[model samples]
Target: MTAARTPLYEEHVRLGAQMTNFGGWVMPLQYSTIREEHHAVREAVGLFDLSHMGELRIGDETLVQRVLSRDVTRLRPGRIQYAVLCNDAGGIIDDVLVYAMPDRGYLLVVNAGNQDGDFDWIRKHAQAADAARNVGREWALIGVQGPRAVDLVQRLTPSDLASVKYYAFVDGTVADVSCVISRTGYTGEDGFELFCGNADAVRLWRALLEEGRSDGIRPAGLGARDTLRLEAGMRLYGNDMDAQTNPLEAGLDWTLNLEKDFIGRDAIMTSRQRGLARQLVGFKMLDRSIPRHGYRIVSDGEGVGTVTSGNVSFTLGYNIGMAYVPPAMSEPGTRLGVDIRGAAAPAEVVPLPFYKRPHPK
Candidate 1:
């Protein structure tokens, strides 16, 4: 089977990006080095080819103060809301951003791997009831992140994004490209995500590259993306949590609004009340060894957990990871161990979000 190619695949190769397969698509793993690419995003502006993500336009009779699938009704139009799309069992389908457009329609930015599954899920749930329509095929998504991202994109965009509050979006044109720009990102920096169509892909990328040359806007790859999200304590789908784990155990309770009834509400409510048995927690390697996905977690001469996401932090100068451990081992300051092949490295369970963004939220 051949992997798919995004519109920006060739552009990544042209810029000397180290390519790799992600969700059956050839994507840039890194442009120069992972450390340099990660640092560039934290210190300055960085561009990323996020074209592989799936986008949907949802229209309806109008959502209530909050939507059933996600906590979006709490969000106002022309703003961005981070939410999790859940299965009927209360398991996560995908974590995505919802843009309540000023134009009355809504835009949903979903992960590439979860596109078809999520689209089917949304359609199934929304169609079950009248007045809701799923509009996914009409949009393509892109992300521009880093500290100086605002100043760089400001030149091409007509609307003053600075006036747009955090987690808010503005309806406007960038370089005259008809689209929606949102003040949101996954890299834990001040960034914007642009939503457009196939017709505007080339123009959007070219305009940003030309206008952002004065700033440090380089095309970043998925490798840097992993490190950056990790430092920010953001979780990834199919790794950090899945159908077996519920939001309460995943530390995403704040996203779930029990006040309104939705799918899987009863199951989650039960778990929350009964208390979480197993949970996802973050830790740093007390020793030099690095933890990887599926790595065994050990403590007190017993196997009690497994690591979900792991990497050597080029930015933090240490190894960090998130793991699923017994509820007893999840508390901060608890000592633990991780199996790095034949060696069991010393580690300690610590608080989440190992790295903090210096920017004011």
Candidate 2:
């Protein structure tokens, strides 16, 4: 079967991006270099095509509650909430962002690879009166990330950008195209994600690039995006957690609202009662070696766990990673070793988010 291509496929090729298949979609892996694009997002601004992500519109509050891990009804219009979709077994199906639209409806932005599965899961549980629409293919999502993102995006829209606080959104016209602009991003930076129709994607992308030319806005790709998110300590669905991993062990307790009865609450409670066997923790390499997925983690000269996500933080110039280890060995300041290619490399557990952006005055 042939892989699908996003609306920005031709545009990426024209811009000389190196393309690769991601979640069955042909996407840009890098434009120039991963390090350069990664630094651009940290120092200036970077544009990303997140059109591959799935968007679902669910109108029923009761149905939303049953499918989400958080209190979706508590979110007022124009706000956004981060939550996870759990299976009956209490394992995560996907980590999603819920947007409370001005129309009193909810928009869910889900993982690209899990789009079909998530849709099927939601539909199967949805009541006959409940309505859920797959809007992923109908809209293109553009992520403008960094400190300068707001300034550049504000120029193209009449909406008061500053009025839209973090995790909030507004409906407005951007460069003559109607869109939903949200003050949210995955790179742990102050940025805006513009949701526009597929027909206007190229135009909006080019317009943002032209408007932000002086601000060092570069077209970034998946490679830089992965590194940026890893530096921020964000969990990737397939790697960090899956159907077998629960929220409590993945360090995502904040996203779970067990007070409200949702799917998997019982299983989650069961896991809590049984005690967590392991927990996800962040670490920095003490030796000159890079960590990779599936690398064995050793504590006291015995295999304790394995690395889920690992990378050399281009911005920090240090090798950092996250691994699932026994809860006893997951605390900060704990010493451990990563078996990199059969050689044990010393590492130390550290607080998550190896990189943190400076707060604006």
Candidate 3:
């Protein structure tokens, strides 16, 4: 199958970025270097093209409530909630963001790779054939992330960003382009995600890069995005969990609301009652070795688990990764070993979020 190109594809090439196929889309892997772009986001600002993400517009409140793990009725207009879609067996279908539109209805922002399957699953369960619409291809998503992101975006909009609290959104204009200005990001930084029409993507992307030049803003890519999210202790869909993995074992129990009836609630309850065989936990390498995904985790000369996400954290200056281990060894400070090649490298479980942005004074 041919990979699709985003509206910013040409711009990425013009900027001499390394391009790679990701989630069926040709995306920038890095503009200059992963480390450089990672630091740019931490210290200054970074622009990202997230057009590959799926957007589903649903008008049926009943359908929304039935499929999502969180209670959507309580999600007020202009607010967003992080939730997961689960199957009957209590396995996660996809982790998604539910945005309650101010005008009416709801928008589900889902991972790019799972968009088609998610749409098919949701439509199969809908009362009416038109209850849900997959508009992922018609829109473009640009993420402006970093410490200076708020100020950089504020200069181009009249939306009074101060009123748009975290986890909230406002329909407004930026750089003369209409957008859904959402105060949410995956980098664990203060930022906004602007969603706009596909035709307006280039204009918005260029405007941000030009205006943010003074602030040391750079166009970040998938490589830097991965390292940034890892340091933030954020979970990647395919890496941390998948269709065969339940949310309970992924440490995402907070996303489940058992009080309200929803899909997979009963199975999830049954799994809880039965007890989880393994739990996901964060760890840091004790030696100079860097952990990688699929590396075997060992304890007492026995292979216990496998690393899900691992990388050298530029912000923390240490090797960090997440893995699923038995409940007994999931605690912080527990000693384990990562199998790097044929040798067991020392590692210790640590609290997640190896790095956190300082609070504004």
The CA lDDT of each predicted structure is 0.79, 0.92, 0.94
Question: 104-188 in candidate 2: lDDT tens per residue?
Answer: 8899999989998998899998886348889999999999999899889988899999899999999998888899999988898
Residue 44 of model 3, lDDT score: 96
Name the weakest run of 10 consecutive residues (lDDT summed) in model 2: 125-134
TM-score of 3: 0.99
- The candidate with the higher lDDT, 2 or 3, is 3
lDDT of model number 2 = 0.92
Q: Give the runs in model 3 whose Cα sits over 4 Å from its true position.
A: none
Please, what is the TM-score per model? Answer: 0.93, 0.98, 0.99
Q: State the lDDT of candidate 1 residue by residue for 1-361, as single tens digits.
A: 6777777767788888889887766788998988888988888878887777777667751442223445566677777777776666778777777777666767777777777776766666564454344344455567889888888888887787769777887768988888778787878888888877767877788888888888877778898899999888899988998878888878888777787777777778888888888898999999888899999998766788999999988778999999999898898898888988856788888897888777565
Q: Which is the leading candidate under lDDT?
A: 3
| Better structure of 1 and 2 per TM-score | 2
| Tens digit of per-residue lDDT, candidate 3, span 95-117 | 99999997679999999989999
In terms of lDDT, model 1 sits at: 0.79
